[model samples]
Target: INRLSSALIRTSTKCINALDALRSLKDGLDQHPSITKEEKERLLNFISVARQEYDEIAKKEIQKAFVYSYEESAKVLFDNYLDNIEAYCNSTKLKDPITDEEVSPDEKLMRSIEEQIGVSENAKKSFREEILLRLSSYARKGRKFDYTSHERLREAVEKKLFADLKDVVKITTSTKTPDAEQLKRINGVSAKLISEYDYCPVCANELLKYVGSLLNR
Candidate 1:
């Protein structure tokens, strides 16, 4: 059961990671001005399809893990039952029946044990089926992506503008040192670009300094 649980966790992580990668790719497309609007739309649609497919795959993996765990649990229970029955029979030295046609004590005990095991297995199977039905229903519900989507969009915009503004630095450097207003414009553009991406102030400052150095060179 522990091993099966771990497998399920690993499977879920893999699915999440794959979805994250697709999301990152979509964000990159959104930020790239070189990519046409139509192409971006097509790529976004592809990502959507990939997400749907991954969701289905994750559902199936969860179901498979549950089924395997339950089956293993049943087998362990059955084995423990057999071990307990054997111990009981060994501890109690019961003889065979006096009459040749009569059933022996050991035979009777084996029959009872088998009947009990059958009952337990049936109960487990019914319970497993019920849980699976509930899981299927739960999986059909929609999930929220607002927070993640917003973050990805912000990051994409930041990356796109940063690349675009690199050219501005080069152009300014080709001429003499930029005046106060020119520097202000450059700082404004950098600030606006990083703000959209939600970069921390320290990181944004460092990025601006790097760009300033490039312009000075």
Candidate 2:
């Protein structure tokens, strides 16, 4: 529907609900006198099928859970990990951002991120060193190193972030009636999708359920 709306009908698709667009198209077809009855009927039939498909999928997906895209949250975690990873590889301590205490680099955390892109335990040192070296180079060049600095690292970071959030996303999305905290979080996430991620409320909620179902499976 979204693709048809944008590419075929030239409707604004992003943040504009697909169903709404289909309905609007149906209305236009109904009113436009120049379009032949046969063509109108054929298009209307297509819209009906599309609407049914959308409805059936939405009914199934409404209960599933999802998180924001990689740019929204994953890189933030990746950068923080980068800040402490070198020390972790060096067998030293790093500061905990939340607790303001010296803590060891979490081997599990580092490996969890690296494992997503097929980094092996034996090669972990070289990966970390390469990342850190790039970080230094970026700093010297008056720039910032990020997931975009390394392709595999970006994939790893995104995959790790999605994996790490799976359980929480499942809980949040699958709940029919959330508690106060959950409701707040849901509203905040939805709002962020609308404001920052260019999703309309309809698509945003639909996306949450879609990802939620994927995680459950």
Candidate 3:
């Protein structure tokens, strides 16, 4: 009877230790920064399964020989749990948080066009080729415009490019020449674009001159 009692005591201790280890593992996983909410839930589910296994072992009829078997079973369960945790942690990829400040597709396209135009010796020549290429690509892709005519498509493209410019630069238009306030805004935008995008100053000036000519026409 003493031997049986001692065996029961050892088995109980082992079971308690296994449960504690499982709980500790779960707590660590819960606090991990890289572990996503879904991954954490997966880890918790495994821990719950380990707890169920331990509970079932504890409820069985106690014997001197059964104690060793229980201990061995508990060891195997906990070892497997640890191995799974290690694999999951190793396999899980941490992703950058999605931000609203990320550049939009339209902005990316505009930037590419701007870079192409700004890098050339003749801004007007570069702008004409870039615009033609874009229009040609759209035509080849069978893209339909609200207007039925090619002239309207060209007008729409110009409007879109300028509209996008307003988002990054403040440009208010009037029938007459730019007023003092308008010039100030234009200068502010020019400095900002040059600073932010490393745009060529001379090219930027030439581009603005072209835009002014278009608006006047």
Q: Give the TM-score of candidate 2.
A: 0.54
* Model 2 per-residue lDDT tens digits across residues 23-69: 77787775679899899889999999998787655432332222343
Candidate 1 ranges with C-alpha deviation above 4 Å = 1-16, 72-217
Give the Cα error of residue 215 in candidate 3, in Å. Answer: 86
lDDT of model 1 at residue 66? 25
Model 1 per-residue lDDT tens digits across residues 31-52: 5799888888888899899977
Q: How accurate is candidate 1 locally (lDDT)?
A: 0.44
Ranking by lDDT: 2, 1, 3
lDDT (10s digit) by residue, model 3, range 116-191 = 2243434533443544555457778897422213443333333334343433222332224677766665565456
Estimate the overall C-alpha local distance difference test score of candidate 3.
Answer: 0.43
Report, for every candidate in turn, its global Cα lDDT versus the true structure.
Answer: 0.44, 0.71, 0.43
- Badly placed stretches (over 4 Å) of model 3 are 1-16, 61-217
* The best candidate in terms of TM-score: 2
RMSD of 2: 8.9
